[model samples]
Target: MTVATTDLDRLKSGADQLFSKKKLAGFSIPLVIIAYLVYIFFAFDVPGLYSRADMDNARTLVADSYSYKMHVTRDNRSAEVDISIEGRRNGTYPEDGSPDWVTRGEETVIDLGQGHIATFGPEIVTYTIPGYGTFRAEPGRSGVNATFPDGDLPGWINASKNRVAITTEAGRFTVTRNRTEVFRYFNGWEAFWFTLDSPYYGLSVGEVAGRAVQGEAGDIFTAFWTNSMWRHQDVAWALFETVLMAFLGTFGAGLIALPLAFLAAKNFAPLMAVRFAMRRMFDFLRGVDALIWTIILARAFGPGPLTGALAILVTDTGTFGKIFSEALENVDKAPIEGVQSTGASAIQRYRFGVIPQVVPVLISQLLYFLESNTRSATVIGAITGGGIGLLLTQAIITQQDWEKVTYFIVLIVLMVMAMDWISGILRRRLISGDGTGH
Candidate 1:
């Protein structure tokens, strides 16, 4: 080796030493800055959290129940129904089959067999049967048959059109027929639940109930939370939209960032001066927080996934450009020189020698940016008025407690973790270092 030593070897060794020192110096400030930022970000909490009233509000929002009101409408229809009273053991239609009515102690039967809740409106006649304390609302339908003993007929019940009023002895309720209406009892909305849901004003449930079930939406639950409460389908759909926003935002940004990176690379750029300018521009772009970008985009385009995506795209361009250019700069000049000595064109030199060396770095950087962007997307979605974060903000503002707040937080965390794991795997396989991604 002492006999064969050459000038090229010395130049290469000196360049490596210089590179190592410069790299170490460059990383120092970034590492310190990152450490400080992570510390502050983790420890920070909303100022509103300190107030007792705010804490109580948050708790109330999260602790709320789940109930919903559905609007139903129908045209005029009536069918006579039979009312009956019998013990659990055995029963038969009474002999005479007259409209037998009963009181708390009495029993009655009618020609029309037992009816459903549809018949159980306030106008419908009903009275206690001897053994069963449960009130029954039989929808009024004409020409049905059953028999009963005598008492005062209650009134014409029509639960179909009014707020259902049903009373019954819990232990003993069964239908002789597999009547669908009878099954309705099992499916009927609970009275307590009615107070928890949002009901729209134009619907009969709200009109009869006095106040809209939810407010602002002008539905029932708004009033009810004002008074106990609960709330998922619509929420889930909105959440789904938020996830979509993140996906599109990240994907679109990656498309633009990839090419800009090559141009920003000092090894690939047409001129050294141009490369320097582009590198500085990239630094400026990435230095600006994604959230700030989102705000700017939202103002330019209005609230939408486009703003979120543009923010990611704009930010990622800076990030990828820096990474790609660094990778280009660090490339082995020996291979490039070998290609050039062969009289290869500039493009051909890069294609054969430079690209192969940097491909791994490009892939690793791409994966890293994609992973980072997912978390950024969530944050941008929140502040820029798109994605699950928007609704999450509402939940926080409304002071819903642990459950509602936990719901979105859990989703976001899981998504970020999944992204990190995937990126790590890709980076390990593609990048030169023996890092976790492998």
Candidate 2:
């Protein structure tokens, strides 16, 4: 009985120790997490980032994504005025005219709505705001000479000896010794379906449809398809190039990895050295990201879709090799043995036994990679200058083509979604053994 009592006391002591360790761990885990978070917060300069953020620029960028602007610029030296959409040459107004809001005579009068008027004379520009009164600037040999209302200049107007700028809800105006410019913001994409030069520019949808019924469909489509600003034809081709990159990369990787996977699998490769070499090769491939590979390949082959495809192929080959080796290792041995008993050669045994067992995994992984690669190809294309990514990069670089950027972004998203759907369907059908439609 004394021995039994001692055993119970020992069990109680052990339980108490376990509970103490558990309690300490629970408290320590939270403290460690909090400490790490505090370190990250200071290391990343969270407060500095907040101070550096420009909310006004952010607002303007967001606005530009969905809107367009009309530029009315006058060369002060020659007194020549030109009106264009977003200041693009193709979107310039015809010689015959200007918008209804602008009136031309001895002087050009621009009505900026809500009683805001800007008039450009031979060497002077005048802007009148309803409650703010009139402001004028003249470009001379020295600089832009300016006059304003009696009170202190509002914060919206910035003036210096060489330049004067006025910003209002209606529009913006800037005057310098070289030029006088006015910008008017408007909602929606400009020249989306047809440019100003197109004959079909001002047609209503119903009118366009009637024209189509009357055999003008080809002309209308040609105009839209060849739109310079939007570049519909170019965009379509870019999307195709992107898809091609993903296709070649993913399947090429799969093909290259399949055989190599056997060399890595311990069950198939009897030599430990060969298995280790193959595994390390895979590690090397997947370890250095695809972007690094793209840069290396671009140097060798020059930038193009093919180079991007090769980079993806190399990276995914390693990944596929690892996955395929694992799948091969886990495969059932019964089928392999059964095929061997039938006097099948090594290659034939693998074909009839190993392939059939892993076909589903192979197809599923291949299709998933194909889908994933489609998105990867876009980033790769940006580096290679071959696909929609090229156009996207160009738009971003322009800094004024946010609308185009938005359009390209939308196309990219749609392209990825379509690829995802296609891959999903192919995976389901192939895995279900219904690929032949029987």
Candidate 2 per-residue lDDT, tens place, 1-438, comes to: 999999999999999999999999999999999999999999999879878998876887799999988998889998888889999998998866888988876688999888999999987799999998999888877999899989998999999999999999999999999999999988999899999999888789999999999999999999999999899999999999999999999999999999999999989999999999999999999999898999999999998899989999999999999999999999999988998999999999888888888888989999999989999999999998889889899889987788889999999999999999999998887888643222
What are the per-residue Cα lDDT tens digits for candidate 1 across 102-182?
111122222122532222232233333443333443333432122223443343322333333333421122221112122
Report RMSD for candidate 1.
18.6
What's the CA error at residue 332 for candidate 2, in Å?
1.1
Model 2: which residue pairs collide?
Answer: none
lDDT of each: 0.53, 0.92
lDDT, model 2: 0.92
Query: Runs in model 1 with CA error above 4 Å?
Result: 1-55, 58-255, 270-272, 340-344, 428-438
